[model samples]
Target chain A: NAGVTQTPKFHILKIGQSMTLQCTQDMNHNYMYWYRQDPGMGLKLIYYSVGAGITDKGEVPNGYNVSRSTTEDFPLRLELAAPSQTSVYFCASSDVDRGFPGYTFGSGTRLTVV
Target chain B: AQTVTQSQPEMSVQEAETVTLSCTYDTSESDYYLFWYKQPPSRQMILVIRQEAYKQQNATENRFSVNFQKAAKSFSLKISDSQLGDAAMYFCAYRSAFGPRDTGRRALTFGSGTRLQVQP
Candidate 1:
């Protein structure tokens, strides 16, 4: 199984630009999440999805949006990117039955907004 | 609300030695989960070990073990026979068992990571 996969391992965006960070999991997990990690800081959740058509904002969801149209895909949209948005983003998935078991993380997408 | 804290920002251990990373969390809920995740240079978060709140005995996996103190709200991870591959940033996370009752919105709160250096 490909477990979890994230696209565009690295990218650079200009202020006011927009882009989507793509994430997919073949494990058929019901839970998917988007988190950003700054240097020396713990990861902060931006958004999460329970299932298709369901999404919710997390602790640090500002300047970002998410949509889960299918069980395998949960994409994060950054509208009007800013320099503060530069960080390493990770896509994760897990089965709810396991009651929040350890997440399977993607290789992470490093974003730099100038 | 829950919060996790990792007191140590950086640590060093000689190769083949042992090291313990300290973690403490604040949570009112009695039932919860604690985890230690490793992020190597590759930036992949891997689960090192996990401890259930109710479990009295500390959780151990091979050379990785957790010293879970329920009352003290302390959870420390000990890595024995450390190797170069064990060098990475470790994060402690907490998840509350009680949520909106929908059960699908549960999320983890992570502490600032501790970077471990394995000296050869």
Candidate 2:
């Protein structure tokens, strides 16, 4: 099974551009999250959803947005992408009701903005 | 809010030897979970080991294990029989057991991370 799938493994954008990072999971998890990892740093939560139609801001949510329209998909949107937004983005999901083991993270999307 | 810290930025271990990466966290909640994740060059975040705050016994998976000191809020990962394949960046993460209804958010808080290099 494709646990968590993130599209556009690599991408480059210019300032003021916009893009969406896709994330899909087949595990039927209720909780999904978006995180950005800068070089030499750990991952920072950007946005998350406990279930469909319920999204919330995370630690770093200024330049990004997220929507969970269905159980299997949670996409991250970058609006007016700036150079400071350049970082590797990761998508993760977990089922909290099932005695949550750990998050299943996607391979991640490496993005660069100039 | 919980915060995790990994003091060691880099570490090395000889092949087949053992190495431990330290992680400390600050949290007011007593019921929480700790985890260690390995991210190789592929950037795949793989769960190494996990420990529930209530569980006094450490968690182990094959060659990976964790020393969870609940009172100290310290969780360290120990890799036994280290191999070249074990070379990767390791991260420590914390998650509160409090349901989203109580905390409004249940996402994990992660530490900076420690890069481990297995030497031959």
Please report the candidate that would top TM-score against the real structure.
Answer: 2
Candidate 1 lDDT, A29-63, residue by residue in tens:
88899999998899999999988998998889999
lDDT, each prediction: 0.91, 0.92
- Model 1 reproduces a share of the real contacts of 0.61
Alpha-carbon shift of residue A69 in model 1 (angstroms): 0.8
Tens digits of lDDT, candidate 1, B42-78: 9989998988898899999999999999999999999
Report chain B TM per candidate: 0.95, 0.96
Off by over 4 Å in 2: none
Best model number under DockQ: 2
lDDT minimum window of 10 residues, candidate 1 chain B: B97-106
**For all candidates, what are the clash counts?**
0, 0
TM-score of 2: 0.97
Per-residue lDDT, model 2, residue A80, is 98
Residue A83 in model 2: lDDT: 97
> How well docked is model 1, in DockQ terms?
0.62
Tell how far residue B78 is off in model 1, in angstroms. Answer: 0.5
True contacts kept of 2: 0.78
